[model samples]
Target chain A: DAGVTQSPTHLIKTRGQQVTLRCSPKSGHDTVSWYQQALGQGPQFIFQYYEEEERQRGNFPDRFSGHQFPNYSSELNVNALLLGDSALYLCASSRGQGSEKLFFGSGTQLSVL
Target chain B: GIQVEQSPPDLILQEGANSTLRCNFSDSVNNLQWFHQNPWGQLINLFYIPSGTKQNGRLSATTVATERYSLLYISSSQTTDSGVYFCAVEEYSSASKIIFGSGTRLSIRP
Candidate 1:
């Protein structure tokens, strides 16, 4: 079922540049969530998308924004990236917003130089 | 906001050995899950135990929801089990934010 698919397995961007990472949820799944994992740390929730709208947000700033499509696919866009933003970006999908049994995709490793 | 904490920040064991990992949360949660992050940066779901116990082959997990803690037991550990184990929780509320603990790094020797 491809579990969850994330695009651009690796990305390199310069400070102040913009980057977008994409994700396709598992089959029949309707909810998508985004997370950022720094080295040696567990993933931190960035936001969640359900019904093509953001339902919950984390401590991340507006520079980290996202969109979910009708097909339950999602895109994470970072504007004016900073070196500290370099990390592994992960995408997870589940059946419903309340469900916690998530399937994650191989994250996109973003390197902000 | 909920706080999740995992014990034994790091573990080293020999193949065929058994070990246990613990996770504690600061607040009540509706769901709890365990994940293993491989070297390739992929999170593989291990268990979705909000309460009670579940066994999957040589792996078993028990969650004491009333105590706000969960435990993962790995028997006959293999080299492939060498990775980071994380415990995540979904706090009870209309807006669910799954928070992950710092994780316990496991290393198995051949």
Candidate 2:
């Protein structure tokens, strides 16, 4: 059984540009969540998707949006990126929702140039 | 929103040494998890301990939900264990959200 997988291991974008990162959840998992991990800090919750709809969200702004496909894969799109947006974008998957164990991917390293 | 705090932001130890990391939350939590971020920035789940105590080889975790704190113990540390240890919690209010602590950076020297 493969664990969570993320595409575009690393990326570089300029301010005001948009970027989309993708994730494939672990086998047998249905819930996907996104997190932002700034340098020297812990991972902060971005949002979560379940059954093709957003179930919960964090304190992030509207520029940060996500989608969940029927297969349980997810995409995190950041529009008008800022220098402050440069961080490791991590995607985690769980069996359902609520308080459950999570399996995380390696993460996409986004650098705003 | 609940507050999560971790102690000993940074630690260095020789191989075979032992260490303990603590996490304190502001309110009672229904879920508590520990993760280790490897050098490559991969967040690996270490424990899913909401309450009670669990031991896995050289690693063990104990969560005192009543006290709103959790402890992660590492025995006979190895260089492979060098990474940032983070404590994440989920309160009953939010179903999908998890609040994470700053984490403890651990460096094990061989």
Most DockQ-accurate candidate: 2
The digit string of per-residue lDDT tens for model 1 on B1-110 reads 78899999999999999999999999989999999999888999999999999999999999999999999999999999999999999878635699999999999999
**Model 2 stretches with alpha carbons more than 4 Å out:** none
lDDT of 2 at A84: 99
lDDT of 2 by residue, B1-110 (tens): 99999999999999999999999999877899999999999888999999999998999999999989999999999999999999999876786689999999999999
RMSD per candidate (Å) reads 0.8, 0.7
lDDT at A89 for candidate 2?
96
In candidate 2, the residue pairs with backbone N, CA or C atoms under 3 Å apart (3 or more residues apart, or in different chains) clash, namely: none
lDDT of 2 at A40: 95
Give candidate 1's error at residue B110 in angstroms.
0.4
lDDT of 1 by residue, A54-77 (tens): 999999999999999999999999
Q: Model 2 - which docking category?
A: high
Q: What C-alpha lDDT do the candidate models reach, one value each?
A: 0.95, 0.95
